[model samples]
Target: MTSSPLSPYLRDFERLADLETSVHSLLSSHGQEATFHHVKAVAQKAAELAERFSGNVEEVSAAAWLHDISAIIPNRERIAVAQGLRLEVLPEEADFPMIIHQKLSAALAEEAFGVTSQAVLSAISCHTTLKANASKSDHIVFVADKIAWDQAGTPPYLPDLLVALEASIEAASLVYLDYLWEMRARLKVLHPWAKAAREALRADVSKLQTDKSLRF
Candidate 1:
Protein backbone atom coordinates (compact mmCIF):
# COMPACT_ATOMS: atom_id res chain seq x y z
CA MET A 1 0.00 0.00 0.00
CA THR A 2 1.25 3.46 -0.85
CA SER A 3 1.60 5.59 2.23
CA SER A 4 1.09 9.31 2.63
CA PRO A 5 4.37 11.21 2.70
CA LEU A 6 5.15 12.95 5.95
CA SER A 7 7.63 15.76 6.21
CA PRO A 8 10.94 14.79 7.76
CA TYR A 9 10.24 17.11 10.67
CA LEU A 10 6.81 15.66 11.25
CA ARG A 11 8.23 12.15 11.30
CA ASP A 12 10.89 13.23 13.75
CA PHE A 13 8.32 14.88 16.01
CA GLU A 14 6.17 11.78 16.15
CA ARG A 15 9.13 9.57 16.98
CA LEU A 16 10.41 12.04 19.54
CA ALA A 17 7.04 12.32 21.26
CA ASP A 18 6.81 8.56 21.59
CA LEU A 19 10.32 8.42 22.97
CA GLU A 20 9.49 11.17 25.44
CA THR A 21 6.36 9.41 26.63
CA SER A 22 8.34 6.26 27.22
CA VAL A 23 10.90 8.18 29.20
CA HIS A 24 8.20 9.88 31.22
CA SER A 25 6.67 6.52 31.97
CA LEU A 26 9.99 5.31 33.26
CA LEU A 27 10.34 8.34 35.48
CA SER A 28 6.81 7.86 36.76
CA SER A 29 7.81 4.35 37.77
CA HIS A 30 10.48 5.93 39.90
CA GLY A 31 7.99 8.42 41.38
CA GLN A 32 9.47 11.40 39.59
CA GLU A 33 6.31 12.53 37.84
CA ALA A 34 6.80 16.06 39.13
CA THR A 35 10.18 16.24 37.48
CA PHE A 36 8.76 14.85 34.26
CA HIS A 37 5.94 17.40 34.30
CA HIS A 38 8.33 20.27 34.92
CA VAL A 39 10.58 19.22 32.07
CA LYS A 40 7.66 18.64 29.71
CA ALA A 41 6.14 22.00 30.56
CA VAL A 42 9.45 23.71 29.89
CA ALA A 43 9.66 22.00 26.53
CA GLN A 44 6.13 23.14 25.63
CA LYS A 45 6.80 26.75 26.61
CA ALA A 46 10.08 26.67 24.71
CA ALA A 47 8.29 25.51 21.58
CA GLU A 48 5.73 28.31 21.91
CA LEU A 49 8.48 30.88 22.32
CA ALA A 50 10.33 29.45 19.35
CA GLU A 51 7.22 29.86 17.23
CA ARG A 52 6.94 33.46 18.36
CA PHE A 53 10.56 34.01 17.31
CA SER A 54 10.03 32.54 13.81
CA GLY A 55 11.81 29.35 14.71
CA ASN A 56 11.10 25.97 13.10
CA VAL A 57 8.00 24.83 14.99
CA GLU A 58 8.41 21.12 14.49
CA GLU A 59 12.10 21.18 15.35
CA VAL A 60 11.55 23.15 18.56
CA SER A 61 8.55 21.06 19.55
CA ALA A 62 10.50 17.86 19.06
CA ALA A 63 13.43 19.30 20.97
CA ALA A 64 11.14 20.20 23.85
CA TRP A 65 9.74 16.68 24.07
CA LEU A 66 13.11 14.96 23.95
CA HIS A 67 15.30 17.34 25.91
CA ASP A 68 15.11 15.45 29.19
CA ILE A 69 15.08 11.82 28.12
CA SER A 70 18.20 11.03 30.05
CA ALA A 71 16.48 11.84 33.32
CA ILE A 72 14.92 8.42 32.98
CA ILE A 73 18.29 7.03 33.95
CA PRO A 74 19.79 7.55 37.38
CA ASN A 75 22.27 10.40 37.76
CA ARG A 76 25.08 8.08 38.78
CA GLU A 77 24.40 5.85 35.80
CA ARG A 78 24.52 8.82 33.47
CA ILE A 79 27.91 9.84 34.86
CA ALA A 80 29.33 6.33 34.55
CA VAL A 81 27.98 5.78 31.06
CA ALA A 82 29.14 9.16 29.84
CA GLN A 83 32.54 8.64 31.35
CA GLY A 84 32.84 5.14 29.86
CA LEU A 85 31.93 6.55 26.48
CA ARG A 86 34.42 9.41 26.86
CA LEU A 87 31.77 12.01 26.16
CA GLU A 88 33.70 14.95 27.70
CA VAL A 89 31.00 15.89 30.19
CA LEU A 90 31.73 18.75 32.57
CA PRO A 91 32.23 17.88 36.22
CA GLU A 92 29.24 19.91 37.34
CA GLU A 93 27.09 18.24 34.73
CA ALA A 94 28.37 14.81 35.65
CA ASP A 95 27.56 15.53 39.28
CA PHE A 96 24.12 16.91 38.48
CA PRO A 97 23.06 15.02 35.38
CA MET A 98 19.47 15.57 36.36
CA ILE A 99 19.99 19.27 35.78
CA ILE A 100 21.48 18.73 32.32
CA HIS A 101 19.60 15.77 30.92
CA GLN A 102 19.44 17.44 27.52
CA LYS A 103 22.95 16.38 26.62
CA LEU A 104 22.14 12.71 26.94
CA SER A 105 18.78 13.32 25.30
CA ALA A 106 20.52 14.76 22.26
CA ALA A 107 22.83 11.79 22.02
CA LEU A 108 19.93 9.38 22.30
CA ALA A 109 17.96 11.29 19.66
CA GLU A 110 20.94 11.08 17.30
CA GLU A 111 22.13 7.53 17.93
CA ALA A 112 18.82 5.76 18.51
CA PHE A 113 16.38 7.71 16.36
CA GLY A 114 18.67 8.86 13.56
CA VAL A 115 18.10 12.56 14.26
CA THR A 116 21.34 13.69 12.68
CA SER A 117 20.60 17.34 12.04
CA GLN A 118 23.06 19.38 14.03
CA ALA A 119 20.62 22.25 14.54
CA VAL A 120 17.95 20.06 16.12
CA LEU A 121 20.54 18.20 18.14
CA SER A 122 22.02 21.45 19.37
CA ALA A 123 18.66 22.86 20.40
CA ILE A 124 18.00 19.70 22.36
CA SER A 125 21.52 19.64 23.77
CA CYS A 126 21.57 23.21 25.05
CA HIS A 127 17.98 23.66 26.19
CA THR A 128 18.93 23.63 29.85
CA THR A 129 22.38 25.20 29.69
CA LEU A 130 23.42 27.90 27.24
CA LYS A 131 26.63 27.31 25.29
CA ALA A 132 29.11 29.83 23.85
CA ASN A 133 28.26 29.11 20.22
CA ALA A 134 24.56 28.52 20.73
CA SER A 135 22.43 28.95 17.62
CA LYS A 136 19.15 30.85 17.36
CA SER A 137 17.26 27.65 18.02
CA ASP A 138 19.42 27.05 21.06
CA HIS A 139 18.63 30.50 22.44
CA ILE A 140 14.97 29.98 21.74
CA VAL A 141 14.93 26.74 23.67
CA PHE A 142 16.96 28.19 26.50
CA VAL A 143 14.63 31.15 26.91
CA ALA A 144 11.55 28.99 26.69
CA ASP A 145 12.93 26.72 29.35
CA LYS A 146 13.50 29.63 31.69
CA ILE A 147 10.09 31.17 31.09
CA ALA A 148 7.94 28.09 31.37
CA TRP A 149 4.41 29.02 32.34
CA ASP A 150 4.02 26.19 34.80
CA GLN A 151 6.82 27.53 36.91
CA ALA A 152 5.45 27.88 40.46
CA GLY A 153 6.46 30.09 43.35
CA THR A 154 7.60 32.71 40.84
CA PRO A 155 7.60 36.36 41.81
CA PRO A 156 4.63 38.61 40.96
CA TYR A 157 6.39 40.58 38.23
CA LEU A 158 7.66 37.53 36.41
CA PRO A 159 6.32 38.65 33.03
CA ASP A 160 9.03 41.29 33.08
CA LEU A 161 11.43 38.50 32.32
CA LEU A 162 9.77 38.03 28.94
CA VAL A 163 9.76 41.76 28.37
CA ALA A 164 13.47 41.88 29.03
CA LEU A 165 13.94 38.90 26.73
CA GLU A 166 12.11 40.71 23.92
CA ALA A 167 14.14 43.89 24.27
CA SER A 168 17.48 42.61 22.92
CA ILE A 169 19.61 39.52 22.57
CA GLU A 170 22.17 41.00 24.90
CA ALA A 171 19.53 41.65 27.54
CA ALA A 172 18.19 38.14 27.17
CA SER A 173 21.71 36.71 27.39
CA LEU A 174 22.35 38.64 30.58
CA VAL A 175 19.21 37.17 32.13
CA TYR A 176 20.35 33.69 31.15
CA LEU A 177 23.73 34.28 32.73
CA ASP A 178 22.09 35.52 35.87
CA TYR A 179 20.04 32.36 36.04
CA LEU A 180 23.09 30.14 35.58
CA TRP A 181 25.02 32.06 38.19
CA GLU A 182 22.18 31.83 40.68
CA MET A 183 21.72 28.15 40.03
CA ARG A 184 25.41 27.42 40.43
CA ALA A 185 25.49 29.33 43.69
CA ARG A 186 22.36 27.66 45.02
CA LEU A 187 23.82 24.26 44.31
CA LYS A 188 27.24 25.19 45.62
CA VAL A 189 28.85 23.55 42.60
CA LEU A 190 30.20 24.39 39.18
CA HIS A 191 30.53 22.71 35.82
CA PRO A 192 33.12 23.54 33.16
CA TRP A 193 30.48 24.09 30.47
CA ALA A 194 28.46 26.25 32.84
CA LYS A 195 31.57 28.24 33.63
CA ALA A 196 32.22 28.71 29.92
CA ALA A 197 28.67 29.92 29.34
CA ARG A 198 29.07 32.35 32.23
CA GLU A 199 32.35 33.62 30.82
CA ALA A 200 30.84 34.17 27.39
CA LEU A 201 28.09 36.28 28.90
CA ARG A 202 30.58 38.20 31.07
CA ALA A 203 32.44 39.10 27.90
CA ASP A 204 29.21 40.33 26.33
CA VAL A 205 28.43 42.35 29.42
CA SER A 206 31.91 43.84 29.23
CA LYS A 207 31.45 44.79 25.57
CA LEU A 208 28.09 46.33 26.34
CA GLN A 209 29.67 48.37 29.11
CA THR A 210 32.52 49.39 26.82
CA ASP A 211 30.07 50.52 24.12
CA LYS A 212 28.16 52.57 26.67
CA SER A 213 31.39 54.18 27.85
CA LEU A 214 32.41 55.03 24.26
CA ARG A 215 29.01 56.63 23.61
CA PHE A 216 29.33 58.69 26.78
Candidate 2:
Protein backbone atom coordinates (compact mmCIF):
# COMPACT_ATOMS: atom_id res chain seq x y z
CA MET A 1 0.00 0.00 0.00
CA THR A 2 1.14 3.54 -0.68
CA SER A 3 2.15 5.69 2.28
CA SER A 4 -0.65 7.98 3.40
CA PRO A 5 -1.89 9.59 6.58
CA LEU A 6 -4.85 8.18 8.46
CA SER A 7 -8.06 8.16 6.48
CA PRO A 8 -11.68 8.49 7.52
CA TYR A 9 -13.00 6.15 10.20
CA LEU A 10 -14.01 3.24 8.00
CA ARG A 11 -10.82 3.23 5.97
CA ASP A 12 -8.75 3.67 9.08
CA PHE A 13 -10.39 0.63 10.66
CA GLU A 14 -9.63 -1.54 7.63
CA ARG A 15 -6.09 -0.25 7.33
CA LEU A 16 -5.41 -0.65 11.03
CA ALA A 17 -6.60 -4.26 10.93
CA ASP A 18 -4.23 -4.94 8.06
CA LEU A 19 -1.43 -3.25 9.95
CA GLU A 20 -2.01 -5.43 13.00
CA THR A 21 -1.98 -8.62 10.93
CA SER A 22 1.17 -7.56 9.15
CA VAL A 23 2.86 -6.81 12.48
CA HIS A 24 2.05 -10.29 13.77
CA SER A 25 3.56 -11.95 10.70
CA LEU A 26 6.65 -9.78 10.83
CA LEU A 27 7.33 -10.38 14.50
CA SER A 28 6.66 -14.11 14.32
CA SER A 29 8.90 -14.60 11.31
CA HIS A 30 11.65 -12.75 13.14
CA GLY A 31 11.33 -15.00 16.25
CA GLN A 32 9.97 -12.15 18.30
CA GLU A 33 7.03 -14.13 19.58
CA ALA A 34 7.34 -12.70 23.06
CA THR A 35 7.45 -9.16 21.68
CA PHE A 36 4.42 -9.94 19.56
CA HIS A 37 2.47 -10.96 22.63
CA HIS A 38 3.65 -7.91 24.50
CA VAL A 39 2.52 -5.67 21.65
CA LYS A 40 -0.94 -7.25 21.76
CA ALA A 41 -1.14 -6.68 25.49
CA VAL A 42 -0.08 -3.07 24.98
CA ALA A 43 -2.67 -2.62 22.24
CA GLN A 44 -5.42 -3.92 24.51
CA LYS A 45 -4.34 -1.61 27.30
CA ALA A 46 -4.08 1.32 24.86
CA ALA A 47 -7.66 0.82 23.64
CA GLU A 48 -8.97 0.87 27.20
CA LEU A 49 -6.90 3.95 27.96
CA ALA A 50 -8.15 5.71 24.84
CA GLU A 51 -11.69 5.13 26.06
CA ARG A 52 -10.98 6.33 29.58
CA PHE A 53 -8.72 9.21 28.59
CA SER A 54 -10.56 10.43 25.49
CA GLY A 55 -7.70 9.66 23.13
CA ASN A 56 -7.95 8.61 19.48
CA VAL A 57 -8.25 4.83 19.76
CA GLU A 58 -7.29 4.09 16.17
CA GLU A 59 -4.11 6.11 16.27
CA VAL A 60 -3.20 4.86 19.72
CA SER A 61 -3.75 1.22 18.74
CA ALA A 62 -1.66 1.63 15.60
CA ALA A 63 1.23 2.99 17.61
CA ALA A 64 0.88 0.24 20.19
CA TRP A 65 1.11 -2.46 17.53
CA LEU A 66 4.07 -0.86 15.75
CA HIS A 67 5.98 0.46 18.77
CA ASP A 68 8.50 -2.34 18.84
CA ILE A 69 8.31 -3.58 15.27
CA SER A 70 12.00 -2.86 14.75
CA ALA A 71 13.07 -5.34 17.41
CA ILE A 72 13.74 -7.58 14.41
CA ILE A 73 16.91 -5.52 14.00
CA PRO A 74 19.52 -6.75 16.44
CA ASN A 75 20.49 -4.24 19.11
CA ARG A 76 24.05 -4.06 17.78
CA GLU A 77 22.81 -2.93 14.38
CA ARG A 78 20.19 -0.49 15.61
CA ILE A 79 22.43 2.57 15.53
CA ALA A 80 23.62 1.94 12.01
CA VAL A 81 20.09 1.18 10.84
CA ALA A 82 18.80 4.35 12.47
CA GLN A 83 21.55 6.35 10.83
CA GLY A 84 20.78 4.74 7.50
CA LEU A 85 17.17 5.75 7.94
CA ARG A 86 18.39 9.29 8.73
CA LEU A 87 16.77 9.10 12.16
CA GLU A 88 18.41 11.21 14.81
CA VAL A 89 20.70 9.07 16.92
CA LEU A 90 20.66 10.60 20.36
CA PRO A 91 23.85 10.27 22.37
CA GLU A 92 22.02 8.00 24.80
CA GLU A 93 20.87 5.75 21.96
CA ALA A 94 24.44 5.39 20.68
CA ASP A 95 25.58 4.19 24.11
CA PHE A 96 22.58 1.83 24.48
CA PRO A 97 21.27 1.15 21.00
CA MET A 98 18.33 -0.86 22.31
CA ILE A 99 16.72 2.45 23.17
CA ILE A 100 16.74 3.42 19.51
CA HIS A 101 14.27 0.66 18.56
CA GLN A 102 11.38 3.04 19.05
CA LYS A 103 12.64 5.30 16.26
CA LEU A 104 13.30 2.32 14.01
CA SER A 105 9.83 1.03 14.68
CA ALA A 106 8.38 4.39 13.72
CA ALA A 107 10.38 4.29 10.51
CA LEU A 108 9.11 0.79 9.73
CA ALA A 109 5.59 1.85 10.48
CA GLU A 110 5.96 4.47 7.79
CA GLU A 111 8.17 2.62 5.29
CA ALA A 112 6.60 -0.83 5.46
CA PHE A 113 3.13 -0.33 6.90
CA GLY A 114 2.43 3.04 5.28
CA VAL A 115 1.62 4.67 8.58
CA THR A 116 2.23 8.31 7.72
CA SER A 117 0.13 10.00 10.34
CA GLN A 118 2.31 12.20 12.52
CA ALA A 119 0.17 11.37 15.54
CA VAL A 120 0.77 7.63 15.18
CA LEU A 121 4.41 8.01 14.17
CA SER A 122 5.19 10.38 17.01
CA ALA A 123 3.61 8.06 19.55
CA ILE A 124 5.50 5.07 18.17
CA SER A 125 8.73 7.04 18.23
CA CYS A 126 8.39 7.94 21.88
CA HIS A 127 6.50 5.00 23.33
CA THR A 128 9.58 4.00 25.29
CA THR A 129 10.94 7.38 26.40
CA LEU A 130 8.11 9.83 26.15
CA LYS A 131 9.02 13.36 25.03
CA ALA A 132 8.05 16.66 26.56
CA ASN A 133 4.58 17.95 25.63
CA ALA A 134 3.39 14.49 24.65
CA SER A 135 0.01 14.29 22.98
CA LYS A 136 -2.90 12.30 24.44
CA SER A 137 -2.10 9.39 22.11
CA ASP A 138 1.56 9.56 23.13
CA HIS A 139 0.61 9.56 26.83
CA ILE A 140 -1.80 6.67 26.34
CA VAL A 141 0.67 4.43 24.49
CA PHE A 142 3.51 5.24 26.84
CA VAL A 143 1.50 4.44 29.96
CA ALA A 144 -0.13 1.41 28.35
CA ASP A 145 3.25 -0.01 27.36
CA LYS A 146 4.41 0.32 30.95
CA ILE A 147 1.22 -1.21 32.28
CA ALA A 148 1.65 -4.18 29.95
CA TRP A 149 5.43 -4.29 30.29
CA ASP A 150 7.31 -7.19 28.66
CA GLN A 151 9.05 -8.17 31.86
CA ALA A 152 8.35 -11.65 33.27
CA GLY A 153 6.04 -10.81 36.20
CA THR A 154 3.45 -8.15 36.84
CA PRO A 155 4.80 -4.62 36.90
CA PRO A 156 5.17 -3.65 40.54
CA TYR A 157 4.13 -0.08 39.77
CA LEU A 158 0.85 -1.08 38.14
CA PRO A 159 -1.36 -0.50 41.14
CA ASP A 160 -0.28 3.05 41.81
CA LEU A 161 -0.10 3.84 38.13
CA LEU A 162 -3.64 2.55 37.66
CA VAL A 163 -4.85 4.82 40.40
CA ALA A 164 -3.13 7.74 38.78
CA LEU A 165 -4.59 6.72 35.41
CA GLU A 166 -8.05 7.19 36.81
CA ALA A 167 -7.17 10.82 37.35
CA SER A 168 -5.63 11.59 33.94
CA ILE A 169 -3.15 10.36 31.34
CA GLU A 170 -0.71 12.98 32.53
CA ALA A 171 -1.10 11.68 36.07
CA ALA A 172 -0.39 8.12 35.02
CA SER A 173 2.55 9.29 32.94
CA LEU A 174 3.96 11.07 35.97
CA VAL A 175 3.72 7.93 38.04
CA TYR A 176 5.81 5.91 35.59
CA LEU A 177 8.25 8.74 34.85
CA ASP A 178 8.73 9.26 38.57
CA TYR A 179 9.54 5.60 39.02
CA LEU A 180 12.23 5.83 36.36
CA TRP A 181 13.50 9.06 37.81
CA GLU A 182 13.96 7.41 41.19
CA MET A 183 15.95 4.64 39.57
CA ARG A 184 17.91 6.81 37.19
CA ALA A 185 21.17 5.89 38.84
CA ARG A 186 20.90 2.31 37.68
CA LEU A 187 19.81 3.21 34.15
CA LYS A 188 22.48 2.93 31.47
CA VAL A 189 21.61 6.47 30.49
CA LEU A 190 18.61 8.58 31.30
CA HIS A 191 17.55 9.80 27.91
CA PRO A 192 17.11 13.57 27.77
CA TRP A 193 13.65 13.14 26.33
CA ALA A 194 12.59 11.14 29.36
CA LYS A 195 13.97 13.75 31.74
CA ALA A 196 12.12 16.50 29.89
CA ALA A 197 8.97 14.39 29.86
CA ARG A 198 9.16 13.84 33.62
CA GLU A 199 9.55 17.52 34.33
CA ALA A 200 6.72 18.40 31.95
CA LEU A 201 4.48 15.78 33.54
CA ARG A 202 5.29 17.12 37.00
CA ALA A 203 4.01 20.51 35.90
CA ASP A 204 0.94 18.95 34.33
CA VAL A 205 0.13 16.89 37.44
CA SER A 206 0.65 19.89 39.68
CA LYS A 207 -1.77 21.94 37.62
CA LEU A 208 -4.31 19.15 37.91
CA GLN A 209 -3.96 19.09 41.67
CA THR A 210 -4.29 22.82 41.91
CA ASP A 211 -7.37 22.78 39.72
CA LYS A 212 -8.98 20.15 41.93
CA SER A 213 -8.20 22.20 45.02
CA LEU A 214 -9.85 25.26 43.51
CA ARG A 215 -12.95 23.25 42.61
CA PHE A 216 -13.40 22.35 46.28
Candidate 3:
Protein backbone atom coordinates (compact mmCIF):
# COMPACT_ATOMS: atom_id res chain seq x y z
CA MET A 1 0.00 0.00 0.00
CA THR A 2 1.02 3.57 -0.42
CA SER A 3 2.70 5.56 2.31
CA SER A 4 -0.58 7.24 3.01
CA PRO A 5 -3.82 5.32 2.57
CA LEU A 6 -5.84 7.25 5.08
CA SER A 7 -6.90 10.75 4.22
CA PRO A 8 -5.61 13.76 6.13
CA TYR A 9 -9.19 14.79 6.81
CA LEU A 10 -9.68 11.82 9.16
CA ARG A 11 -6.78 12.72 11.44
CA ASP A 12 -6.43 10.58 14.63
CA PHE A 13 -10.08 9.65 14.79
CA GLU A 14 -9.63 6.62 12.61
CA ARG A 15 -6.91 3.91 12.55
CA LEU A 16 -4.87 5.26 15.42
CA ALA A 17 -7.24 3.94 18.11
CA ASP A 18 -7.28 0.42 16.75
CA LEU A 19 -3.54 0.41 16.16
CA GLU A 20 -2.90 1.56 19.71
CA THR A 21 -5.22 -1.11 21.06
CA SER A 22 -3.49 -3.84 19.12
CA VAL A 23 0.01 -2.70 20.08
CA HIS A 24 -0.89 -2.24 23.73
CA SER A 25 -2.38 -5.74 23.85
CA LEU A 26 0.64 -7.31 22.22
CA LEU A 27 3.12 -5.59 24.51
CA SER A 28 1.02 -6.41 27.57
CA SER A 29 0.85 -10.06 26.54
CA HIS A 30 4.62 -10.10 26.30
CA GLY A 31 4.91 -8.40 29.71
CA GLN A 32 6.73 -5.51 28.09
CA GLU A 33 5.08 -2.74 30.05
CA ALA A 34 8.05 -0.45 29.70
CA THR A 35 8.03 -0.77 25.94
CA PHE A 36 4.32 -0.13 25.76
CA HIS A 37 4.67 3.08 27.70
CA HIS A 38 7.62 4.19 25.64
CA VAL A 39 5.78 3.57 22.37
CA LYS A 40 2.80 5.51 23.64
CA ALA A 41 5.01 8.45 24.50
CA VAL A 42 6.63 8.31 21.09
CA ALA A 43 3.31 8.15 19.30
CA GLN A 44 2.06 11.19 21.18
CA LYS A 45 5.18 13.13 20.45
CA ALA A 46 5.13 12.05 16.82
CA ALA A 47 1.57 13.16 16.30
CA GLU A 48 2.40 16.51 17.77
CA LEU A 49 5.37 16.95 15.50
CA ALA A 50 3.39 15.83 12.47
CA GLU A 51 0.81 18.48 13.17
CA ARG A 52 3.49 21.11 13.65
CA PHE A 53 5.38 20.14 10.53
CA SER A 54 2.39 19.39 8.25
CA GLY A 55 3.44 15.75 7.98
CA ASN A 56 1.28 12.65 7.73
CA VAL A 57 0.10 12.35 11.30
CA GLU A 58 -1.60 9.01 10.82
CA GLU A 59 1.46 7.45 9.27
CA VAL A 60 3.74 8.88 11.91
CA SER A 61 1.51 7.72 14.76
CA ALA A 62 1.13 4.22 13.35
CA ALA A 63 4.88 3.85 12.85
CA ALA A 64 5.73 5.29 16.24
CA TRP A 65 3.42 2.86 18.05
CA LEU A 66 4.78 -0.13 16.18
CA HIS A 67 8.41 0.95 16.03
CA ASP A 68 9.46 -0.95 19.15
CA ILE A 69 7.10 -3.89 18.87
CA SER A 70 10.05 -6.15 18.17
CA ALA A 71 11.84 -5.18 21.35
CA ILE A 72 10.31 -8.18 23.07
CA ILE A 73 12.54 -10.37 20.94
CA PRO A 74 15.70 -11.34 22.74
CA ASN A 75 18.79 -9.54 21.42
CA ARG A 76 20.53 -12.86 20.76
CA GLU A 77 17.75 -13.94 18.39
CA ARG A 78 17.30 -10.57 16.69
CA ILE A 79 19.70 -11.37 13.88
CA ALA A 80 18.11 -14.77 13.37
CA VAL A 81 14.62 -13.31 13.36
CA ALA A 82 15.66 -10.59 10.92
CA GLN A 83 17.16 -13.22 8.66
CA GLY A 84 14.06 -15.38 9.00
CA LEU A 85 12.02 -12.39 7.85
CA ARG A 86 14.35 -12.05 4.87
CA LEU A 87 15.64 -8.69 6.05
CA GLU A 88 19.12 -7.73 5.02
CA VAL A 89 21.71 -8.50 7.69
CA LEU A 90 24.27 -5.77 7.81
CA PRO A 91 27.67 -6.54 9.29
CA GLU A 92 26.93 -4.19 12.13
CA GLU A 93 23.60 -5.94 12.77
CA ALA A 94 25.41 -9.27 12.90
CA ASP A 95 27.77 -7.95 15.57
CA PHE A 96 25.11 -6.04 17.50
CA PRO A 97 21.82 -7.62 16.60
CA MET A 98 19.79 -5.40 18.87
CA ILE A 99 19.99 -2.73 16.21
CA ILE A 100 18.00 -4.97 13.87
CA HIS A 101 14.84 -4.51 15.91
CA GLN A 102 13.83 -1.56 13.73
CA LYS A 103 13.69 -3.76 10.64
CA LEU A 104 12.00 -6.58 12.54
CA SER A 105 9.42 -4.17 13.86
CA ALA A 106 8.67 -3.00 10.33
CA ALA A 107 8.27 -6.56 9.16
CA LEU A 108 5.94 -7.34 12.01
CA ALA A 109 3.97 -4.19 11.40
CA GLU A 110 3.20 -5.48 7.94
CA GLU A 111 2.92 -9.22 8.69
CA ALA A 112 1.09 -9.14 12.00
CA PHE A 113 -0.50 -5.71 12.19
CA GLY A 114 -1.52 -5.64 8.54
CA VAL A 115 0.10 -2.29 7.95
CA THR A 116 0.77 -1.74 4.26
CA SER A 117 1.68 1.88 3.89
CA GLN A 118 5.25 2.02 2.61
CA ALA A 119 5.66 5.31 4.42
CA VAL A 120 4.70 3.79 7.75
CA LEU A 121 6.84 0.72 7.19
CA SER A 122 9.81 2.80 6.10
CA ALA A 123 9.54 4.99 9.20
CA ILE A 124 9.41 1.90 11.40
CA SER A 125 12.34 0.42 9.53
CA CYS A 126 14.65 3.29 10.41
CA HIS A 127 13.26 4.88 13.54
CA THR A 128 16.36 4.01 15.56
CA THR A 129 19.07 5.06 13.13
CA LEU A 130 17.35 7.09 10.48
CA LYS A 131 18.57 6.58 6.90
CA ALA A 132 19.58 9.09 4.24
CA ASN A 133 16.76 10.84 2.36
CA ALA A 134 14.24 10.10 5.08
CA SER A 135 10.73 11.46 4.56
CA LYS A 136 9.04 14.09 6.71
CA SER A 137 7.10 11.39 8.57
CA ASP A 138 10.37 9.54 9.17
CA HIS A 139 11.89 12.67 10.65
CA ILE A 140 8.81 13.20 12.80
CA VAL A 141 8.90 9.71 14.27
CA PHE A 142 12.66 9.71 14.79
CA VAL A 143 12.69 13.00 16.61
CA ALA A 144 9.62 12.01 18.60
CA ASP A 145 11.27 8.82 19.79
CA LYS A 146 14.25 10.80 21.03
CA ILE A 147 12.05 13.44 22.61
CA ALA A 148 10.15 10.77 24.47
CA TRP A 149 13.19 8.69 25.32
CA ASP A 150 12.81 5.50 27.39
CA GLN A 151 15.40 6.45 29.98
CA ALA A 152 14.56 7.35 33.56
CA GLY A 153 15.42 11.02 33.19
CA THR A 154 15.17 13.50 30.34
CA PRO A 155 17.60 12.73 27.56
CA PRO A 156 20.80 14.69 28.10
CA TYR A 157 20.53 16.01 24.55
CA LEU A 158 16.89 17.05 24.73
CA PRO A 159 17.52 20.74 25.28
CA ASP A 160 19.82 21.05 22.30
CA LEU A 161 17.64 18.72 20.25
CA LEU A 162 14.54 20.78 20.92
CA VAL A 163 16.38 23.89 19.89
CA ALA A 164 17.40 22.27 16.64
CA LEU A 165 13.92 20.88 16.11
CA GLU A 166 12.57 24.42 16.28
CA ALA A 167 14.78 25.22 13.31
CA SER A 168 14.02 22.08 11.27
CA ILE A 169 13.56 18.33 11.53
CA GLU A 170 16.88 17.67 9.78
CA ALA A 171 18.65 19.85 12.27
CA ALA A 172 17.09 18.00 15.19
CA SER A 173 18.05 14.68 13.63
CA LEU A 174 21.62 15.93 13.13
CA VAL A 175 21.76 16.99 16.75
CA TYR A 176 20.94 13.46 17.91
CA LEU A 177 23.24 11.89 15.36
CA ASP A 178 26.01 14.15 16.53
CA TYR A 179 25.50 12.80 20.04
CA LEU A 180 25.65 9.25 18.75
CA TRP A 181 28.78 10.03 16.78
CA GLU A 182 30.41 11.44 19.93
CA MET A 183 29.60 8.24 21.79
CA ARG A 184 30.51 5.91 18.94
CA ALA A 185 33.43 4.46 20.87
CA ARG A 186 30.98 3.02 23.41
CA LEU A 187 28.65 1.59 20.76
CA LYS A 188 29.06 -2.07 19.84
CA VAL A 189 29.02 -1.15 16.16
CA LEU A 190 27.92 1.88 14.23
CA HIS A 191 25.28 1.04 11.70
CA PRO A 192 26.13 2.28 8.22
CA TRP A 193 22.65 3.75 7.70
CA ALA A 194 23.25 6.04 10.68
CA LYS A 195 26.64 7.07 9.38
CA ALA A 196 25.21 7.87 5.97
CA ALA A 197 22.30 9.72 7.54
CA ARG A 198 24.66 11.92 9.57
CA GLU A 199 26.77 12.79 6.58
CA ALA A 200 23.68 13.52 4.47
CA LEU A 201 22.23 15.75 7.17
CA ARG A 202 25.53 17.62 7.55
CA ALA A 203 25.61 18.34 3.85
CA ASP A 204 21.92 19.27 3.71
CA VAL A 205 22.12 21.57 6.71
CA SER A 206 25.29 23.21 5.48
CA LYS A 207 23.74 23.84 2.09
CA LEU A 208 20.60 25.27 3.71
CA GLN A 209 22.71 27.62 5.82
CA THR A 210 24.76 28.65 2.83
CA ASP A 211 21.65 29.30 0.76
CA LYS A 212 20.19 31.40 3.55
CA SER A 213 23.44 33.37 3.80
CA LEU A 214 23.27 33.99 0.05
CA ARG A 215 19.64 35.09 0.18
CA PHE A 216 20.45 37.64 2.88
Best-fitting candidate, measured by TM-score? 3
lDDT of 1 by residue, 57-84 (tens): 7777767666666655566577666665
Supply the TM-score for candidate 3. Answer: 0.90
Tens digits of lDDT, candidate 3, 1-216 = 433211121133222348888787777766788999999999999999999989998899999999998876778777766776577999998988888889988887876678899999999999999999999998899999999998898798899999998888888999999999998999888889999999999999789889999999
Off by over 4 Å in 1: 1-32, 149-152, 155-160, 182-185, 205-216
User: What is the model-wide C-alpha lDDT for candidate 1?
Assistant: 0.65
Clashing pairs in 2: none
Please report, in order, the local distance difference test score of every candidate based on alpha carbons.
Answer: 0.65, 0.85, 0.85
Better of 1 and 3 by lDDT: 3
TM-score of each: 0.72, 0.88, 0.90
TM-score, structure 2 vs. true: 0.88
| Cα RMSD of predicted structure 1 | 7.1
Candidate 3 local distance difference test against the native: 0.85
